[model samples]
Target: MTVRLRPHHLLCLLTYIGKGYSPAFIAGLTEIARRVNAGEEVVIVTGPDDICAPLLEDPDAHCHNPGVQIRDANAARDVGALLDRDIRHGLRMVLTPVLVAQMRAAFANQDTRSACARCDWAALCSDIAADGFVGAILQAQDSTAE
Candidate 1:
């Protein structure tokens, strides 16, 4: 389904991004909410997050809450396969804690350092050079790319 953005969603989105939320998470939640309101069967597959329970309480929803298993999944095998599927079919649903964290941190800090250097998207986001509103700006770029 096509997502129609109103002036307010966009405005609130901008504000949220400025606060360090990840654009992907924002898009994912918006998409899910749209589907839920449209009366579609929305199945949310996500890692654990503080807000997941409340969000899933809405009707017409199902949730798969898996904790972060990024490392356990073995990036090359599991992640690559998931990416391959996503590339061809797009995401089946939206609701992942890792995505949430990414969005939250994206809005909170624009610092270049990744707390540690192992952040996967660091280079793509110039996270190593992030500061001030840099993270939010990068997320905007990410949203367009998506």
Candidate 2:
């Protein structure tokens, strides 16, 4: 099955190495990640707030806590649009090496501090990027490229 790929999803896949999010959300995201690693054709979904708001509203969801402020809706939309454009016109796939490289470049080009201000994993993500932990993210490769 094709999964809807979003910028937040890509960021989570890159930086989330351990416990976070509700179990149900984690399970669902894990399945999506698996499909992505298997070279599945992902449909870019730029509306993260729409897709995630309900999930985050669940009391069991990790993001439901008061301390975790939701990301700015406009910024999320902008980032998602950028990623969608890059995936469709630039990379053609959501989880390919080329896509990853392009994403890293995009991150480099922007002041991610503001973009990631609401993310709980932002500090950890910055460390991962500083440490050049691309391998940690790329290890999701589970299928031969189609």
Candidate 3:
């Protein structure tokens, strides 16, 4: 099954290191990270993707926040440009090793980080990238000839 992800989550998957707002959130992200690492395809969605599932119970979930919508838009723009694809709802992709390397380089250089503006975890992600992604959980492999 494809993992449903919001646009910004494409970036989030780059630097996730098992920390979150709560234990449930961390568990959900960890599970998704594992599945993604294990080779699940990722399908883009407009809002409230699998990463937001654990936080959905809150009436004031940040997933529903308007700022998050802007973040998604920015992430789509940056990632789309980097990938040379129209990153819209229903787009399917895999985080292949080469692709991941390119993305990580861009992320480390802040080339695709417009979406990280105002994010609570932005600093942590920056630090992770600065440190060569130490402790990051996701692992990517080339699934096809490129």
Give the whole-model CA lDDT for all candidates, comma-separated. Answer: 0.32, 0.52, 0.91
Lowest-scoring 10 consecutive residues by lDDT in candidate 2? 66-75
> Which ranking of candidates, highest TM-score first?
3, 2, 1
Q: What are the per-residue Cα lDDT tens digits for candidate 1 across 83-128?
A: 3432111223332333323433443453212221343433544532
Tens-place lDDT digits, model 3, residues 108-139: 99999999999999999999999988788887
Error of 2 at 101 (Å): 2.1
> TM-scores, in order shown?
0.20, 0.58, 0.94
Q: Candidate 3: where is the Cα deviation over 4 Å?
A: 140-146
- Candidate 3 has what TM-score? 0.94
On the 0 to 100 scale, the lDDT of residue 43 in model 3 is: 96
Q: Which prediction has the highest TM-score against the true structure? A: 3
In Å, residue 29's CA in model 2 sits off its true spot by: 2.6
Model 1: residues with Cα > 4 Å off, grouped in runs? 1-26, 29-46, 50-117, 125-131, 135-146
